[model samples]
Target: MKKTFVKIGLLLAVFGLLVGCDNSSSEVVPPSSTSEEVVSSSEEEVKLTEQEYQIAVNYIVRSVPLVLERGVKVPTNVERAEAENPLPTPELKYGDNLLLITAGELKYEDEINGVYLYPEYTVTYSFLEQEPYAGFTFEYDDIGRYFAVPEYPRYEAEYDNGGNPIHTVPPAKAARLYVTIHIEERFTTFNMDMILEPQAIIHDYNLADVRSVPTGSVVRVYGYFNGYFSDWNNGVLCDGDVALGLFKLQEFNHMELGKMYAVVGQFTVYNGLPQLQWIKTVSEVEPADHPTVKEPKAVVVSADDFADQLDIGNELSGPLMHKVGTTVVLNFPLRYKAMLDRDGNAVEPGALELGKHADVVLTGKDSDNFEFEVKLSLNYHMGTDNQAAFRDFFVTNADADIYFTGPLGAYNAINLAPFAFEGTLSLTPPVVS
Candidate 1:
């Protein structure tokens, strides 16, 4: 096949490098802000000055680790087996670091086609912690350095059984980068060459993989509700035959009790729990009822861990701040103090008056028997019947152990409460008299 080489440019910034493309027929591409030297080559020989070779080696050694850590896709053919020990290398040395180069090869085709190069032993000293394997590609010209990777396929081609194209000519693979480099003397070059292949499809994540994704990144998650707290517009999605305790917060009406839904949003880690916030899209796909409601893992922690005090306007205070958006079982028991009317006045536990706040005054310390008070806010649309049921439940279960679930979050002032039940506030069943 006929071949050509196109020289591109690279702009190196403090955080990362941005690649540039040049389509002009000129072989001597002007350098941008990044290039310190230039490289030239012909059909038979590829040449780089000693100074240029050293710069390239140093840059690659320092930058490749960052690239891989940024979630750049690893080349398909790179072996991932960590070197139990450092591998052997070639002898020729270059640059102030006396960096050794093992092997280097450059291939060029037509003017419109990009050049390809491979290096065998570039950065042997440092390794990226993110992945088991790492590699980098660069091309230089009179203008600047250029980094390139395999281009992704734009469209999947369809073919007939005979293996010939049924509709149109096959499209060529996309070109990723082009560059030129200036070399002063014969210097050792690294021989690690990464073959550019078509990009692969990425898999969407399940609840099990929530923590593996970087925080604050938009992710797609699908699951069915194990159970939900209608008091708050949040629910738990069950996967892996269990309620992973992955919290999903949505303000749109109510989610069907056992329906499966897919949500695309920013995944946040709040109060040691995985929560989906800033939900962009949520839609019911179908019903998923097989996985029954899974009970929460009841780990005993200090009541202080739940919340020191409920503040209505600012971020949460005390350990509960970190426990936001998570389900926790409090070790210290709180007596149901009183149900406050909407005006924040304390009313009898059985008062029919509807209020926005529920107060829990501490009764005793675990071993020490000390006491403290914590407040809870209830903010949700409970119909007349549901409201009466909630009042009865609180009044009836007043003596039961309280179980709290949902993401700790801020509420608008119109609602008028700093601390509110994120999900459901459970009270243990009172013993029969």
Candidate 2:
């Protein structure tokens, strides 16, 4: 049996200011006479009055967790494993009726394959007692299910400096929304009609917290735009303690390096490192509130030590993996193998290939003479025209000591992709016998 989990949102608009109330009751009460209008003898033939609708909305609002709140703290690997194989609950078994409601501000909407697709919503909710903002995606269809569009009365939305819409709804007006869902095989199929609302609220997060969650989670983080790799179409965001890569930015052209900015995007991971992708917005933050930006110091390590850190079985768990997105100064003896281009084709001796990636393979050995291979990615974006120069020098001096400094990166095995070595690549010729 196939199981799908369908998420739905119910945005409530009340005439008066809605106050938070305690909702600890386990049972849902049927509407009373004052809240219900009976037009027929059957229980299903009754209509809900305004008062009854408000009651239902309130109950749902309290029952469903907010999206943002759930993202604050993600479950650990062990916890995730336990969740995947949980003890069955006696009360909520397969095929039992369930109501899953969530509230959030709409992020964006788009049609997939010419079919109406649901939008991802940003909301705040408490998970395991911690409140964090998270992005939630709901699934819906056009037929066989019932949904009511949420109405916002007299609210005008304006654009922020970043060109994102800002929704400012008065506290007095609210709307009632309804959705009917059916659950089978742990999946949900529902019908819905919704209008995409611009995200009004974005939560602030630190780099550490953002790195803690799984990829594809939406998050808003504030940091300094320290560096960029135009070739890779990404940049780097750094706080004092941690740095993260920013990918698929929508407004990279206007981003000024060394400026503090708040960015909202989906969390992503590449080659065991955390990154932010599909950026929704980028706004400059006031300097007064943010700390002065500082360049991250590179961790010095030997080529052999770097290789040991590249534990394929235990990614992001090793000591070096923790520093994946940061800079590193590598010191090793260069035992030249071959200089290749992006397509793994070896560059002829003394050939200069401009504006392309250079993949240099070298043999690294430890004090015990343990041998390992390391690939270094270089060229165009690294701030120099040293691709041919380095290749020429290394070809002549096959055995030399080298000090290479660049943004520490890894792929499959440990290799630097998109690294810069302006004055960072230094070589010492072998001493005469």
Per-residue C-alpha lDDT of model 1 across residues 340-405, encoded as one tens digit per residue: 665667777666454333432324234445455444454434344445655676678777766543
Q: TM-score of each candidate?
A: 0.35, 0.49
Best by TM-score: 2
**Candidate 1 regions with alpha-carbon error over 4 angstroms:** 1-203, 206-212, 226-254, 269-274, 283-332, 341-352, 355-364, 376-379, 389-433
Each candidate: how many clashes? 43, 13
Instruction: Please report the TM-score between candidate 1 and the true structure.
Output: 0.35
> Residue 176 of candidate 1: its Cα lDDT?
15
- Write down the lDDT that model 2 would get: 0.48
Cα lDDT for residue 430, model 2? 26
Relative to the true structure, candidate 2 has a C-alpha RMSD (angstroms) of 20.6
**CA-lDDT, candidates in order:** 0.39, 0.48
Per-residue lDDT of model 2, residues 1-433, tens digit only? 1122333444221111122322232211122201111121222223333443334433333333322111222222222234657422111111111122333322222245332212222122211111221112222334322122222223433444344545565442222212221111111111111122333344467877777765555568887776676666787777653677788764666887668888887776676667777777787877666565444646666656776765562134445644554666666665777788778898765674766777787777777787777777764766445655666666776767665666655455556543444555667532322
